[model samples]
Target: MSHHSKAKQLLQQRDELDEKVKELLLVLETNNSTMDSPLVDAEGYPLNTIDVYAVRHARHDLICLRNDRAQWTEKIVEEMEQDEEKMGESAPIEEKPVHRTSNEPFVKVSSVVELSPADVGGFRKEDLIIQYGNLHHGNFKNMQQVAEITKEYENKTIRVTVIRDHRPVRLEISPKKWSGPGLLGCNIVPIAGANV
Candidate 1:
């Protein structure tokens, strides 16, 4: 297959892996919450052991899949860069749908309110915000920039790049006033030692 086709396939597989990871997380959360008692079905058949074991197995599979996806993503980027070089390009530049490879923790999501834009946009707990629209890299000044941008672009869709469990996931979030308090309804804190 061509590099482009392979990259597309890898991206699709990565997205599927991400969804599986999310589902596994839900399973783990459910199992943990019911640790005091056995999980049961409609007929009250005990399913705690099965549920826990399934979650554990899913977690292991999630790790392997995430690693594979990460490698594929890297290979795709490398292939793209090589293609660009062949076209006389000497430097790698940021393009639309930017995939950040930075390990610099910019912000850590503290909380996400239910039914909010952040929650609706798949912002989960412990997500590391790498970039959001114009808040990428050295563009953002502080953590308050997220709120400022959200309020400024209320009801407009913007790209948000985040790292969850060492994987980069880009999300599009429309800032809007739902039936809640804030526009995005998410609380985030700057990472320690980051130039906030």
Candidate 2:
């Protein structure tokens, strides 16, 4: 199979695995138990409050599934790198100046609070955001979209792409409860004349 096809298949499998992992985590949450939570009481007897068997099974499966997902992610990244190499080999050698007519950065990071989610996620001031979660320049309307995405993906990692030092950098940021006020604790302002 072609690298593109393989990558697509791997992505589908990864997404399926991710859904399964979420389901298992939900099971653990429903039981009011975490992976490290003690299934047995102080006397070494199984706790009557939660189903020890189900929690144990869920935790075990979660570990295995997470490992599998990591493997899939590695394969996907390899396939993507191979695809990029293949494309580069066939492309012309001439380098043309890039014109940011479309897909221009829609927002810029003005400030990032210390020790916040954005700070922990490697966000820096002046980072030009090209993509956040599913919102990109083409579909992005306003800051409200960014707000909605952060709200929707709270406690979950969101893939963000930014231009830092004229290079595209990918970072994973999760919006979650922290010591800070906001979820991200970053100030993002729309770029001027970006048609936001």
Best by lDDT: 2
**Segments of candidate 2 deviating more than 4 angstroms:** 1-102, 194-196
Inter-residue clash pairs, candidate 2 = none
> For each candidate, what TM-score against the reference?
0.52, 0.49
Model 2: lDDT of residue 155: 92
Which lDDT tens digits does candidate 2 get at residues 1-196? 4778998898888788889989999999999999899998899999999988999999999999977865675576557546766776443355332222244589999999999999999899999887787777777788999999999989987877686754456688989889888899999999987522
- Highest TM-score scorer: 1
- Give one digit per residue, the lDDT tens place, for model 1 in 1-196: 3755765676677777778878877776766732233446678876645565666576677678767766765665555545545565322255344445543557878999988998999998888777777676556568678778788879877777677654567677888978988888888887777621
Model 1 CA RMSD to the hidden true structure, in angstroms: 10.8
TM-score, prediction 1:
0.52
TM-score: model 2 vs. ground truth = 0.49
lDDT of 2: 0.80
Report the Cα lDDT for residue 171, model 1.
76
Pairs in steric clash, model 1: none
